[model samples]
Target: MRPLLVVGGRELAARLRDGTALLVAVVAPIVLATLFGFALGGDDDPPLTATIGIVDDDGGQFPASVQREALQTEELRDVLTFAQYPDEAAAQAAVDSGAAGAAILFPAGFSDSVGEGNGGSVNVIESDESPLAGVVARSMVDRISSLVEARTYAVRASLEAGVPGDQVQEFVEANGAAGPSLTLADDPVSGGQVDLAMYYGSGMAAMFAFFVVGASARSLLVERRLGTLSRIRAAPIPGWTPVVGKMMVGFGLALVSMCATWLSSVLIFGITWGDPLGVFTLILGHAFAATMIIMLLASRAQTDSQADGYTLAVAFVFAFLGGSIVPVYNLPDFLQSLSLITPNGWISAGLTELAAGAGIGTVVVPALVLFGIGSVAGVLAALRLRKGLLS
Candidate 1:
């Protein structure tokens, strides 16, 4: 056991001593994260801002009071940046060119229809790609519709009660308090905690696990090629000692990498990963499972190149099917169901549970599953190596 530990330590030290390993392990991930942050839109969403182009064919005679009310409302003010266009073609052009998020047109007699209590509708066309713009346009349209409805109701009351126009406005104003307020629900569980970020982060870690495990497994092949394995075999140590040593080293390195990624996301990216103990457990479990899986693949592969190819193919396939590339929810039902067989899927789910405030106790099942997988893979690898098939 002690000899194996010494051998494992020697192996780890040799790998770490290389300047290139540090570049690959630490610097590369940081650079990639920074690039991803830039390309995927800023880490923080730029404040909601939209350019709305308005074309009024109503000859400067549209209801100023209603238009002002629509533009200045609390909801629209925060979301829309309004600009007047001279004609429908110009407004449409602006929206099509992405200069404006949306275009609104008030047809001729817009005010006259509202004045007669007929409740006129304006046309709103928006660029389909801008979700924020669609939300703003829809909100503004709904508010305008409500205002027109309120005015029509006021006219009805005035005619019924024989009240003056001035008193009718007061009548509607006095008794218009029936609908729900426009407060948006701010619950993160239901709304704010974006799921894509979760998928990408988990996928990145899972993909990188191949490197750690592959490198450790490659160390064994290198030892055999160099006659070091024969020396170890002739030593007083048991046959499994070197295998245990490699597993320990690989597990430790995997854990460190997991911690680095989790801490980076929390501190630099402002992500809130909940329950430290739960996250730690998941990280450790995933590290062991990933390392064992790679070692098993290494044992089955015929050469270094074969091992590398096999590990890459397996890891990436798991990543893709387990909701690392596209969201699990967006996948077809069969694919989503099939994700259960993937270790990456379990790791992703366990991490999500930790992020959602689950404690170590809550993550016990997934952690156990990870440990079970690791145990099975490790046993299989050890048996294969003992049979001299891997050499």
Candidate 2:
């Protein structure tokens, strides 16, 4: 145990002295995360705003109701503005000239048609440059149309139920005044909103952790090439002692890289990771997994160059497949399932949950899975090292 610790300490000291190792492990992730965060827009940016044109040819209650209730609602006032156009041609011109993102044209006699139980046509004109604005306009018109339809149905039902003909207009007006029974309310699951900065920061950290540990593990090949391993073998140390020591160095470097990235992300970028315990647990698990996998890959290589190649290949594969490059939520369903196979995926998910205000308990499953994967890879790496390096 003493020999193993001495060997591990020596390797760790050597790694700390390597300028390239420090840059790749400690500096690169935070720098890239800052760039990504700024590219995605900051929290200080203004809210979205769009203009919608209104063309009411019918001059009826339905169009008036839409203008009063849907377009001018307090909730939408900050994001949407309305302009009244004299005719459909003027509204279309407004949309084409970019004065308005979209337009709603209520055709002549539209209310009469709706009142007569004949569905009326409502035309929506959308700007080519602002498609989302058009979508919002269309949704608003659709909601008004639904309300009109509901009132028409209620009027027809009252007439059929033996109500006097003179009272039917009263029923229509009353039903139209009453809004839809079911209204949607927002219920956020977590207190903290996970911004783009935190997401890419965590992902960059997870992806680079592989390279950090890989460099440490590949040092075995470096020592072998320099004939240092031969001299070390002549000592009274056991064959497995050097391998265990390298593994320790790899694990230690992995933790350092992850923690450094985390600190930089918070202090420099002002990104909140949420739930300190959860973040640490995820970091520990991912570091263990990264070290084990890099060790396994390094064990299969014959030379330092070959080990570097293997490390680069595996690091990129895991990074791409894992949500480190593209978010898992945006990926296709099949690819999302494939992410579960990588340690990067597990850590990214756990960190994401934490960012979204989840408790420490939420990360337990991910941490356990990471540990399980590391254990399996560690066993395989030990066996391979014993057969190849120890021999």
Candidate 3:
């Protein structure tokens, strides 16, 4: 055990000194994260929005007031294009027929409720055909509702406390929003605080995990081709000691490479990879699977050249189909469907969920898939390695 540990530890140290290894694991992820950040607009850029239908059925002035302000407010003007309707039926039909992704129907008593210091039920007709647009409309409605609540509750409380009606209106008007509003700063909260950095970082790291397989193939297959395996088999140590030591060395280095990428992305890029457990769980599974599969392929190849080619073929093909180079979401639906079979897609999907503030329950499914891949591949590799080497 001590001898194998020493051997494995030495290999880990040697990997630390390799410049190309460091570049793949650390520098490349940072560079790609930066590029994606730029292409997607800066960290502060506003997200996409849709034109939401607005139906003003109120006897009072709440819907009219919001529309008036929407025309004048710079923030609202930029994000929201509101098409006003006379009644709820028209607005609801727009959503139902897919003419509008979402609609906000202000009830007949909406403005009256505000004057009476009571809350009204806002009828939201959101479309299933445009889920993201529906979400944005819902958020907009929530902010507007909160503004109305603040003003209504304040005015009502003041009137009940015996303040003059005109005085209460003046006070409320002075402190409250000129109209309901939204801001660019509030947008990222819908996802997480740092989405851009985490998105690219996850893709880059998952793609680079395959590079460690290249390193593994070179380490093990080159040694075999040089007769080093036969020499080690001749040693007086237990039959499994040298094999376990070599496997440990390769797998440990792969873990370190991935961890270095993950940490640097968080520290330097300001990416908040939500849920500590979620982040590490997917990364650990991905690393183990990549390392094991690479070793298995390398063990099967008869020569160093064949192993190198095999490793590259598997890595690039997986990376392409999994969306490391091209986004899977942008691909045709059939191709996107196919990405589910690849570990790259599974890890990328789980990381994307983490970036969106998902926790253990949301990410455990992908981690389990990765674990299954690693376990099955590791068992097969072990069986094949014993025959390939002991013979």
List clashing residue pairs in candidate 3. Answer: none
Top candidate, metric TM-score: 2
What ranking emerges by TM-score with the best candidate at the front?
2, 3, 1
lDDT (Cα, 0-100) at 56 in candidate 2? 89
Per-residue lDDT of candidate 1, residues 1-391 (tens digit): 5797797898788779875345544555545544554454235655556777788777544435445665666745665677889888998888888889887788887766765567688888878545456555665566566666766766676668887765665565576612223322221221224433443555566656656666777777777778787888787877777766776777677677666766666666676556788777777777888888888887887676787788778877887776655545445669978776777777777776666555667678888988888889888877887776333
| Candidate 3 Cα outliers beyond 4 Å, as residue runs | 49-194
Cα distance off (Å), candidate 3, residue 136:
9.3
User: Highest lDDT: which candidate?
Assistant: 2
Deviating ranges (above 4 Å) for candidate 1: 41-43, 46-192, 195-199, 357-361, 389-391
Measure candidate 1: CA RMSD: 9.0
Query: Which residue pairs clash within candidate 1?
Result: none
lDDT of each: 0.67, 0.79, 0.70
Model 2 CA deviation exceeding 4 Å by range: 46-192
Give per-model TM-scores. Answer: 0.61, 0.67, 0.63
- lDDT tens per residue, model 3, 206-323: 7777776566566666677788767776878676666667677666656776677678667765657778888888888888888878877866888878877887888777777786
Q: What does candidate 2 score on TM?
A: 0.67
Could you tell me the TM-score of candidate 1? 0.61
